[model samples]
Structure formats: structure tokens, C-alpha cells
Target chain A: MKKLVLRLRDLPPSAWIFFAWLVTLSVLPFLIILAMSFAVRSESGLISWTFTLANYERAFHLVYLKVLAKTIFLSLGATITCLLVGFPVAYYLARATPEKRQMGLMLLFIPFWTNFILRIYGIVSIFGNHGLLNQTIMRLGLTDSPIEILYTRFGIYLGLVYNYLPFLVVPIFSALEKFDLSLREAAMDLGANRWQTFTRVLLPNVREGIAIGSLFVFIPMMGEYVIPDILGGAKEVFLGRVMVEQFFTMQDWPFGSALASVLSMGLMIAVWVRMRFEQRKAGPTSHGLR
Target chain B: MGDQRILKVLLNGMLAIILIGGAGFWFARKSNDSAQPVLRICAWSNYLPQNVLTQFQKQTGIRVELSFVSSNEELFAKLKAGATGFDLIQPSDYMSRQMIRLGMLRELDHGQLKNLGNLMEDVRSPAWDPGLKYTVPFSWGTTGLVINTAKVPLSPGEIPGWGMLFESPDPKRTSLLDDMREVFSAMLIWKGSTPNERNHQKLEETLAGLRNIRENILMFTSEPRQYLARSELNISHAYSMDALQAAEMKPEFKYFIPREGAVRWADNFAIPTSAKHVAEAYRFLDFILDAKVASELALKGHFSTQNQPAWDLLPEAEKNNPVLYPDQATKARLYYLEDLGDLLVLMNRMWAELKI
Candidate 1:
């Protein structure tokens, strides 16, 4: 038994176990969904596994394709907005005195410890037509009418920024913490101006952080149903709402699965491209750091 | 090496606790929970008031745990999974018949229900389950056009028909129900056929008529309250209860039963054969059947009273309201939605094709 244990320990602790677990849980669910996309749905709402590309063909119609494109566009817009808002805040937090920084970091995390649904309700209470913001604006005589804000794309953007800001902040904060401060100081000392030092030294160092943050935001923003459903009303149509309509209201499971698989594929391609870019940036550093 | 070993041990301990604690607590809760008797109710999120459950608990000392299912398909899927986790379920009349045929329903002991006689004559002997053998009627409402009278023309004593919608002066300004059964039935009635038509040619004709009115429809929606509150569109075909609820919120909003007649449906509470809290479930049903409780529900919401005594007991303010209790002639022009069986599936497919 000792000999067997020694042999097992000597094998470099194979990562095959983790790979198997991932395949069983994550990859299998995706494959099942992909398989379901090609199945046929009967009038009785029964799904039959008679291989067909009809669902995909049906999905290619102009209305759905336009909605898919719009979803991608919304996700891209949200990801960029998060990075722009989060970068300075993260940098400020990372560079603060250690004592104060802990408190700021804790403040950022305190809201997350509460239920996600409750946090969303908090946003609604603030921005609803009869809510505080509208009441305040109307009281101040900014305009005669309450602004049509909550159910528009503006509302969707506000919701997206509120929910996903922390994801962007956390990773950038970690990257900033591990950042080599000497590189920036040395550049500034050697006649590089503040902007020059920041652009040349700080930006390149945080590429990984931006990629990680964008991936976190972009992937989820694609499948985000609740935020849009609550905030967008019927004015804007996202891919998530379309898929839900197919499954629940329309009773077309195969078509819904097809839409889900298409969304998954889009997200996978995005993550893959981001990883490749990261690898290119990290080419020499992993070995040099070691 | 010693420091590395210590760090490794600490990480492993944390990981072990996270995984095992989560799984163990879940498993322990599942098992420990199995021993306690729960009257599992599968229904909409807020179909029944919370007071009903608490009162039943007070009287019977049994806890009722509710599991919400959002749609008909979801309810069926849970039942099909052989999850006996539910003791009582609320399904519409069409689905109640299907569940009964599938042997998922338990034959109720009518002797347990003293208020069974209080149910209206029409709801008691439904065509779906004749003589109310396996189901207990709860709430019912008709599907009709709810018009904003401030916007739509209202001639003296001239009732609007389905033609106001299908042949609307402005097609782009109308709205319709998103439900297949209700929409298709409305279309059928518009085309001068019986609402329960099995004829394929008649179904196609109905679909074509729906297509004509499609452009006029601003949008199809289930939450009519949201749209009505905004006064987004002037006309909407909706459940009478939903319309009444919205009208109460916005007084200018008015609900009318169309001249071609509309579909009415009843939602029922039934005991599943696999129930563990049959006694408590019955007790809960009986509590809601009480005149005061039923009246309170009807007065507060858009609910039409099935209890005649409760309807009479309500104050004059409520009793005079036509939305809650329509006149005899308006009631005569409405048809209760019967189980169309295979014809429903056919109608659903037809509606899908038209939308495409």
C-alpha cells in the first residue's frame, strides 16, 4: 500500500481528475443542450431526437438575428463602460495606505454579501418613475414631466453598471496590487512625464486584469435576463428574453436550445480570443518571474 | 518545506470544509426535512394569501411549504419527474382533467368539505370533471376585451363586439392576450364559428382573421396591469379579472364582455395522490371557502366571487360594481372554456405559424 501510495504521489498529481469533472458537469451540459437544439418538437410539446437543422434555419430569420446582434452590442457596450468606470477606482484603492485600503475593499464587498435580487430592488426604488430620483427631479423643476428613464436602454445600462462594476474592480485591484511600483517610479525618474510613464508602464501591466474583467462582464451580460426584464420593459429586446419567450410563452424548446447553444458558442469564441491575447502578452514573463 | 506543508494543510482544510459543509448540510437538511410532514403546494407565486396558510397551521398544526411553478408546462414537468413532493396543486380546468386521466389526482372525500355546497352551480359541475369528483373549484373569470372608454367611442347602450378589434378603425392601436387558447378562441368567435371548433378549415380561417388584426396589435402581453396603468394602448383583450384589477387601479379603464361572447376559465385546487398532508390541505381549502375569507379576497383583488353568499355579503360599494358581478345579459354572452383536447394542440400550432 505504501509503494502504491508512493507511485501515485510520484505521478505529478495528474490534472485528469479536474478535466474529467469539468467534462461531466460543464461540458456535458453544453453538449446535451447542443444535441437538444437539433431535436424536433411536436405539437404536444414533446421533444424528439430526430436529427434536423430546422431550428437553426428558423433562428436565422432577420428578427432573431438582429436581436442577437443587438445583444452582442449591448454586452460590448457594458464591458467597456465597466472598465472605464472601474479602472480609476481600483487603482485608487490599490495604491492607498494599507490600513484605509482594507476598509475601502470591505465596503466594496459588503453589498455583494447581500442577496442579488434585493440589490436590484434597491436600484428600482432609486430610479423608478415614482421613485426618489424622479421625485427629486420633478420637485426641482428640471422639467414639467418625469423623465422616461427606468424602462429605456439608459435604465438597462444603469442596471448593468451596478451589477457588474465589482467584477471589473476586483480583478483590476488584484492586478494593481501585484504591480511592480519600481517600474513606474524608474520611468518617471528617467525623464518620462507622468502620462508617458502611465501609458508605457501601467497600461501594459494591467492587460490581464482588463481581459479578466471584460470576460467576467461580457459572458454574463449575454445571458442576463433579470436586469433587462425588470428594467428594459418591452421597448428593448435582448437574446435572453427571446429564448425565454420561446421556451415558456411560445413553447418551442428546440428553438430555445438552439438559441442557447448559439449564445454559448459566441461567449466561448470571445473567451478564447481573450486568452490567446493574454498568452501573447505573458510569453516571457511566466518563465522570467519563476 | 515545513512552511509549505503547513500552508498546504490549511488550504486543504478550508477546501474540505467548504465542499463537505455545503454538501453535508444540504444532505442533512434533505433527510431531516423528509421526516417532517409538509403540505407542498405547487401553484403561482402568490395565488393564495399567506394568511390562509397561517390560519390552517394554527388550526391543524401542520406546516405548508409552497413550491411555485410559473407555467402549465413547468407544473406538468414536475409531476412527470415523479416528485411526490407536492401535496396540493392548482391547475386550470383543462389541465385538471389531464392530471386526473394520468392518475396523478386523488379522489377527494367530499364529506370533509362542509362548504362544498357554497360553490356556484356553474363551477360545481364542470365539463372537465363532471360532478366535481377529483377537483375543487377556487376562482374563475371570463376572457374579454378591456377598453379605455376615455379613448374608445362608447355609444349609448351599444355594446362593442370582437369586430371592434378585428375590424378596428385603427389596427395598430389594439392589443390582444398572449395566451394561445384565449387568442385562438377569440379569433374563432370573431369568424362566426363556435368557440370550440374542431374543423381545420375553420381553424385556418380563424388564423387568417388573427393575421388581419395582427398589425393593429401594439403588443401581446400577460401583465395587462403594466400597460393599462401607462395607458399605452386604448384596447386590450384580457382576462376579466386582470382587466378588473387594472381598472380598479386606473378608474378610466373599463372592461367589456364582447358581443360575440368570450372564453371563461376556472382555476381549481386539487389533492395529489402522493400527498402527505391531506388533512391539512383539506383544512386550508375549507378556511378559504369561508364567506368572510372569500369576500376579503374578492374585494381586495380582481377576483369574481364564486361564493354567492360572499357576493351578497359585500358592501354596496362592491356589490354594485359590474366588473365583479356583471349583469345577467352580459353573463349570458360569455362561454366557459371547455377542454378542447387534441383541438387545442392544433390551435397552438396554427397560432405559431401565423406569428411566423
Candidate 2:
């Protein structure tokens, strides 16, 4: 016991405090939710102590499954779009002079200075049925009628991409900043074209950034409620919205907990699969680079 | 060796400061826990006027903390999650009844409430809470249509019932309430049935009717006032107060209870069973019921007061505002939503499907 105490004391105090805080705030609540997922709901919408699998069974219904599928599809679409749009901007910022890069980065972060909901509302005012976009188009004689832009699937996708674009760009930009440009020069000297150099050398070096950026966008987009609720006009259902309704509106705590548990498990599996795939793809070449 | 000793002393001093600060916080919290009576109220946003709350606080010498909820279900969930510090809660009539049934409300002592006689004869014995045992009526309004007159250009007489909304030529120009109960009730009333139609067949018929016109709807939203003001939506199902408030801002808008029928909703103040400041809660209830205070709150909120003297105090213009005080024939058609019990789940499922 004396040795154990001495060993614990040898570690930095900050690390000990951080570990304690994480366990208390994150781990404990997650464990409690996991425990509640197996509980039963009483007639009056209260959680009962008796253990049951009914909540999990209810979570597997066709409607919930469909919602989960739709959410995944939307998340995947948003992530892919972010990656495609963010890559060029990140590359340019990385290659720019220091002052120019700093200005561009400041511009990127300026949107975040405002409240998130306020930003979404700004988008609404711009793209609403009687919004600036339609007014401009009509005045320009572009069309005879107003275009339906807000409260559509396209609108939801646009909002998600706009909000999360910075997350993707910042990571890729930082990764490119640390990238060894000599590798690209070597590929070109070896008679490889620009595309080949990019694919073979540049892509592999910044694969970590791509993975992280995808994760930053994908995970939050999966659980996104406000964007779809406001922009989608409650026309379509999303998994996060359903889970929230279960907890707040329906007051089915057991079912909500069960849904949340399943979603977390699914996200974990997805992340694990992605890591394994990236590892396998990077195996031989990554070894040579190291 | 000297530097190490200094570091040790600095760390010990930091630890001492933290300990002292934590002790101070604990002691302060303990002292505050017993110092003053605080009346914690949870109600819908803008339900109680700020002036009324301030007056109550001044008179009673008690601090009042206010929290707002968007829906009764949210309030219920908060109470269920052991939000026991709340001394007063404002729930709709049906929700109050439901809370009373669930043993979540404190029975009111009528003897302590001197202004109980101020309540109008009709509201005194509401069907939901006969004799007002557990709740007191705060404000009442009807769920109705708010139209952008500049866009739709139809008078109240020309545009008749729910059919004007359901069979709208341009369904994309109309919006409906997002609430399941309100939407379902509207459908039931449109189909010439009661809002509280409990029969499964009648509900199924209403669901089918809603499905037929579902595509016409622009959206189901709780806040259609903004859309109506912008003329993005020409017609919307809305509460009378919201409609009136929106119309006050944009004169192009007008609110009307459909000639067919509409849902009449009453919000009530009730004490929770776990209330800590019961005396303050009672005082607040009586204070708000005063004729002048009730009149002020009603005028500000743009909802009808249940106090007869308060009604009398209303200006002729406000008294004649059909939206606030509908005619007797319109009042005859208004129905309050009842607690649906087990069928609520079914209704929720049906509403979800309709949205999908």
C-alpha cells in the first residue's frame, strides 16, 4: 500500500485530477445510461427498477431502423461533401504565406464568434421562402416564381455542411502545415505527374487529418437535432430527434436510453472499422515512409 | 535543494487556498439554504407579466426565480426528474388534471385564497378541475387560424371553417400547429366530431382525412406567426394570443376562430406536491388573481382573463376584439382538450406517422 501511494504520487497532479474529473463526469453518466437502458417503464411514464429487454426490442422497430438509416446516409453525405469542399481550401491555406494564412484562418473562425442558433437563423433569413435569395432572383428576372429552398432535404444538407466545414478545413490545414513537401518533390523528380504525386505522397501523409476531420463532422452530424429540426421544418424524422422526443415529449426514459446505447455502440463499431481499414491500407507504404 | 523547498511551500499554499475557498463556498451555501424564502416558478414563457411578478416579490419580501418551458410535457418531465424546488408551476387545464391524477400537485387551500371569488362563474367550475381544488385558472385562449389578409384577401365570413385550410387550393401556403393534440383535435372538429373523440374508429377516420391533405401543408410548426408575418405562409393554425400579437406587429394579418369549431385552452397556476415555499406560492396565486393585476396580465399577454372584474376593466376596444373575447355562439363551439390516458400513445404514434 505504501508503494502504491508513492507510485500514484510520482505521476503529475494535473493528470490525476483530469482522470478523476473524466471518470466522474463522462464515465459515470455513461454507465448510468447503460444501466437505465435495461430498465422497464411504468404506466405513468416513469422508469421502473425491474430489468427488461423490451426497451431494446422497441428500439429495433422498423420506424426507428429507417430513421437510423436516414441519419447515417445524411451524415455520410455531409462528411463526403465537407471533405471534397474543404480539401482545396486547406491546401491553399497551407501553401500560402504566413500573414495570408493567418488572415484566412481568422475569416474561417469569424462565423463561430456568433451563437450557433443565430447563425442558423441567419441562414433561414437568407434562404427562406420570402427570403433574400428569392427576392434577389425575382428582381433579376431569373424566374417567374420563388424557389423552394428552405425546409427541404437540400436545405438540411446545406446547413450541415456550412456549419461543419471549418472542422474539416482546420484539421487538414494543420496536417498539411506539418507535411514534408520534399516527398512531393521527390515523387515529381521520379517522373510522376501531379495527380500521381498527390495520390501517392500527399494523400497518405495527410490521411490522419482526413480521418480526424471525417470523424469531427460525421459523429456530430449523426446526432444533429437542431439543424434538421429548424431547417428541415420537422418534415422528415432523424434518429436524434426521435431519441429526444422519446425522452422529452413521450417521456419514455427506458426506450430513449436504449436507443442512445444502441447508437453509441453503432458509432463505436463504425469508428473501429474505419481505423482498421485505414491501418490495412497504410500498412506496407506507411512502414517504408517511417 | 532550495528551489525544491520553495516549490513545496508554494504547492502547500495553493492547497490551503483551495481548501479555504471550498469551505467558504460550502458555508455560504448552507447559510443561504436557510436565509430567505424563495418562490421558484416554472411556467410557459411570457405567461406571467414581469410587473406582476415584481409586485408579488415586493409585497411578500420573497425572492422569485422564474423558469420557462415550451410545453406541458417538458414541465412534466422536469417535475418527474425531481425538480422539487419549484414552488409554483403553470400547466394547461388538461395537464393540471393529469398532474393531479399522478399525485404530483398539492391540493389548494381555498380558505387562504381571498380572491377566489374574482374568477368568472364559468371558469370557477371548469370540467377538468371541478371546484378548482388543485389549480387556479390563469389565462384562456382558443386555437384558431391566423391569415395574412394581404395574401389570402378573404374576410372572416367568406372563409368558413377548417375546410378553408384543409382543402386549400395552395396547400403549400398553409401551416398547421406542430402539437399532436391540437392537430388531432382540429382534424376531429373538421370531420364534424368532438375534439375529445375517444372512439378508435372516429380517430382512424380523422387520421385518414389528415393524410389526404397532408401534402398540402407547408409545415407543422409551433411558431407560424413569423411565417405569416412574412407572407411566406398565408394561413396557419395558431393560438389566439400569438395571432393577435403577430397581427399587432403586421396589420396585414388577422386571427379568427373557424366557424366550424376550435380548441379552447386554459393555462392554470398550481402548487407542486414537493413545493418548499407553499405560503409564498399561495400568496402569489392570490396576488395574480386581483382584478387590476389580472387585467394587466391579460392585456399584456393578449389572452382572456378569468376574473370578471378584470374583464370589466378591459377597454371597449379590447373587449370588442373578437379574437380575445369571441361571441357566445363561437364560445359554444369551443372545446377543451381532455387527458387521453392510454390512448395518448396511440395518438402520438399516429401523429408521428402523419408527419412522416
Candidate 3:
């Protein structure tokens, strides 16, 4: 027993503890869920020990595939929109004086201080029927009536972009701030047009920040639950809600576990591939600000 | 060097033992918390008022711990997941039947409930739990349409049915209950069947109807009060508890049971097999069964009480409210959503397909 204790002590004690914690709390639970994904759902809504590939097979059905496609489509659409909407704001922030930049950032972060649901309520007030948007449109005589927005696909897309806009902006702003502005000036001095300078020098300089920011938004929007349910009026089904529905409403833990694992597996692969691409982009000498 | 190594080993061994012993002691204390009998209850939110809890504690000296689940399905899933230490749980009619079948509920000692005689005749020997063997009815309600009259034009004398809600002028302004049973019950009854629909032919027909209606409805949600408050929804499928609350808040909102009828359910109090404080749970049950207490709770909590004496104590205006206390003819038309057991699996599949 003393020898065994001595052998155990030979390993760094803190390292052993951390390893144990990670395995118990993270790895073990994930493995259990993976196992459950392979199991069957019983009639009583409990996990049946029978092994089956039926859950995975059912996931591949056309109906479920449509859900998957919609999930990806919405997330990608939101990400792209965020980049377009956020880049200009980030540039302005980066170019602003230090005092103004601080205030701009403060305003951007104010919404975050409030609860997420409350911010969603604020969004609803602005977009609902007879909401501020409609009231203004009516006052201005823009149209005959209120425009339907919240219960449409466009609404979910806008919600995703709206919630993640700040995260996307901060990273791009940082990159632009750290960017040596002389690069832009040098390109223009060499007979480059404004668009040429922007596309060639400025954009390339901030590629790392832009990529990181896009990822920050993309990953969360992929699994977003509340924003769509609240602002989008839950007119559509998404992966996160589907998983929750299976677990809580349907009481089908095995199927919910299967759905979750599929999502997690896809996310892991996507993130891994992105990391690999970034590594190659950054090989040898690091490009862009340190 | 060898002696120093032995000393180091001894020091480490002693430390490990002390840590293990301390952890064990902490767990021991957690399990046996206090001298005061503690009863843990898992019920729907707002069903157990703070004042009721305080009053029960004051009268019986039993400490109460409360938790909430949004739906009966969620409550079932929690118990199935081996969540223990719940002395009492509030499950609706169908859910109580399911729990009884699964042997998850403990048989109630009616003798301990001195106020059992005070319960309404309708619930005393409910179809779900005959003779009140495994459950005691707490609050009962019906599922129906709650309309915002300012948006949807209708006279108080001219009653609207499910057909009107389905064929609503503005489909985008209508909301259905997100619950499978609630949604399917309304759909089934509207399609000329009972709420506890069983015929596969009819079930398939209902499924198709649900799919068609899914696209036209604004959204499906268990909670539609927020939308009604914002005037975002014209028609919503609602429980009496929520509809009444919404009506009270906004005079424009009115609860209406369709002419084709709707589902009725009773949320009941039942002890789980995991209960540790059985005696305390019984005490709390009897306190809730008390006529005056039940009456006060029914009024304050916005739920229709199943205790006749307690309900009798309510003001005539409240008693006469059509939505709360419908006429005997309307009561006869109401159907209970039953525990379909294996058929629930099929219902879940149908819901999944419809949502997709």
C-alpha cells in the first residue's frame, strides 16, 4: 500500500486531480450520452438498454434533414449578415478618438448588462404589431398597415444577427485598432484606389480578427434557442429546441442524446477544421498584428 | 533518506484520510439536515402560494421546500431521471394516472387527511384515481381559446367555436398551445372526436389537420400571456389559470370555451416513492384541504378549486363567472385528457413530424 501511494505521488499531485475532475465531470458524462444515443427509447419514456442504429437512421430522414439544413442555412446567413453590418461600425470605432471609442463600446455593452430575456422583450416592443416600427411607419405614411416580421424566417435571421452583432464587432475593432494605419496610406501612395486599398490591405490585415469574430457568432447562433423562440415567435423548429423538446416534452432521453451528439459531433469537426485552416494561414511568420 | 521517505508517506496518508472523513461528514449532515421535518414539493409555478406555504409551516411546524416544473411531461421526466427527495408533486389527471401505473407514486393514507370529506364530489373518486387512492385533486381547469376582443370582433352573446379560431381572419395573429396533448385534444375534438382519441384512422386524420394548421398559426407556446399583454396575438389556446390571469390584467381579453367543447384536467397532489417526510406531507395536504384556506387560495391563485365548501365560500360574482364556473351543460361537454400509455409514443412522433 505504501509503495502504491508512493507511485501515485510520483505523478504531479495537482495534475492528477485536474485529470480526474475533467474525466469525471466532462469526459465521463459525454461518453454516457454517446452511449445513450445508441440505446433505444422505451414505451414508458425511459431509456431501454436495447442497442439500435434506428435513432441515427431516423435522424437522416428527409424531414429531419430539412431541419438540419435550415439550422445551417440560418446560422450561415446570420454570420454573413453580421460581418456586413459589423465591419463598418468596427472601422468607425477603431478610427474614432479614444474618448468617443470608449463611449461607443460602452453603449454596445449596455444591452449585455441587462438579462437576455429582457433584451428580447425590448426587441419585441420594437417589432411587434402596432410596435414602434409600425407606429412610426403609420405616422410617416410609409404603408397602409403594419408589416409582418416576427413570425417569418427573416425574423429568425435578424434575431441571430442582432444578438451576435456586438461580439462580431469587438474583435474586428480590436484588430483594426492594433493595425498599423500606414499600410493603408502606403497602398494608396502606390496608386491604389480606395476600394483597392480596402480590399487588399485593410481587409487582409484584419482577417484574423474577422475570422475569430465570425466564429464567435457562428457557433452560438448554430445552437441558439431563446432568441428564435422569443423574437422569431417559434414559427420554426431549430436544433436546440428540438433537443429540448425531445428531452422534456417528448421524454425521449435517448433520442435527445442522439440529437445532441450529432450536433456536438458536427460542431467539433467544424471547429477542428477551422483551427487547421487558421494554423496553415498563420504558418512560419505570424501575419497581422502580434 | 529511507526514514524521511516513510515520514513523507505518513504525512500524505493522514491528509487523504482527513479529507475523505470530512467529505463523508458533510454528506451525512446534508441527508439529516435538521430536527424540523422538511417536506419538499415539486409543483407548477404559482400553484403553491408563498402565503399558503408560510401558513402551513406556522400551523404544523413543518419546514417546506419548493421547486417548480413548467409541464407535466417535465415533472415526469425529472422523476424518471431518478431525482429523489420530493415528498409531494403536483401532477395533472393524466400524469397522475401515468405515475400510478409506473408505481412512482405512494398510496395516500386518507385517514390521515382529516379534511378529505371537504373535497368536491367530482374529485373525491375521480376516474383517474378511483376512491382517491393514489392522488388528491388540488386545482382543476379547462383548456380553451382566450381571445382579444379589441382585435377580434365578436359580441359577448355570440359565442365562437374552434372553427372560428381555426378560420381566424388573421392566421398570423393566432397561437396554439405547444403541448402535444393540449394541441391534439383541441384538434381532435374540433375534428369530431373525443380528446382521448384512439382510432388510428381518426388519429391519422388529426395528424394531417395538425400539419396543415401548423403553417397557418402564429406560433405554439405554453405561455401566451406575454403575447396577449403586448396585443401581439388575436387568439390563443390557453388554460383557465392563464386565461383568467390575462383577463384580470386586460379587460379586453376574454376566455371562451368553444361550442365543440375542450379538454379539462385537474392538477393533483401525490406523494412520490422517494418521499422521506411522509407525515409532514400528509399534514400539508390536510391544510390545503381546509375549506377556508382552499377558498382563499383558489381566489388568490386564480385556479378553480375542487373543494366544494371552499368554492362555495367564494363571492357569487366569481362563482357565476361563466369561464370559471361554466353551466352544467358546458361541464358535461368537457373531456379529460387521458394517459394513453404506449400511444403517447406515437403522439410524440406525430408532434415531431408536425413541428419539422
lDDT of 2 by residue, B248-356 (tens): 8988788888888899999999999999889999998999899999999999888988999999999999999876788898889999887676786567556656655
DockQ ranking from best to worst?
2, 3, 1
Q: Which stretches of candidate 3 lie over 4 Å from their true place?
A: A1-26, A140-144, A276-290, B1-37, B170-172, B198-208, B211-216, B320-322, B325-329, B340-356
Candidate 1 lDDT over B114-173, as tens digits, reads 988888776778877898899988777788888887878788776688876777754544
Error of 2 at B86 (Å): 2.4
Q: Is the docking of candidate 2 incorrect, acceptable, medium or high quality?
A: acceptable
lDDT of 3 by residue, A1-290 (tens): 99977876665645566767899998999899899999998765678899998788767767667787888888998999999999999999999999999999999998899988888778778887778998899889998878977777887887888789999999999999999998788888988999988888888788889988998998878778887787766767787777788887777788778888888888889889988987777755464322
lDDT of each: 0.76, 0.85, 0.84
Residue lDDT tens for model 3, B1-356: 55556656866997999999999998886876666778999988877789889988898888789999888888998887789979999988878887898899999888899999998776778888899899989888889999988988897597778875567776878998878888888888888889888888888898898888777888887789988887778799999899988898888888888888989878999999988888889998999999999999889777788898998899998898877788999999899876586676567667767766
Query: Tens digit of lDDT per residue, candidate 1, span A1-290?
Result: 99966654444323434555688999998898899899987645557889999888867766567777888888789888998899998999999999889998898889999898788768767877666788899999997766766656778888888899998899999998989898888888888899887777788787678778878888888888778756654345678876776677555688889989988887788778867876776666642221
Q: Per-residue CA lDDT of candidate 2, range A1-290, in tens?
A: 99978876665656566767899997898888899999986776677889899878877876677778888988899899999999999999999999999999999999999999999999999999878999999999999788988777888898999999999999999999999888888889988999988887888789899989989999889888888878887776677877787788777788788989999888889889988887788656772343
lDDT of model 3, residue A42 = 78
Q: Find the 10 residues in a row with the least total lDDT in model 2 chain B.
A: B1-10
Q: Sort by lDDT, best first.
A: 2, 3, 1
- Model 3, position A25: C-alpha lDDT score: 98
Q: What is the TM-score of chain A alone in each candidate?
A: 0.88, 0.93, 0.87
Relative to the real complex, the DockQ score for model 3 comes to 0.31
Name the DockQ score for candidate 2. 0.44
Candidate achieving higher TM-score, 2 or 3: 2
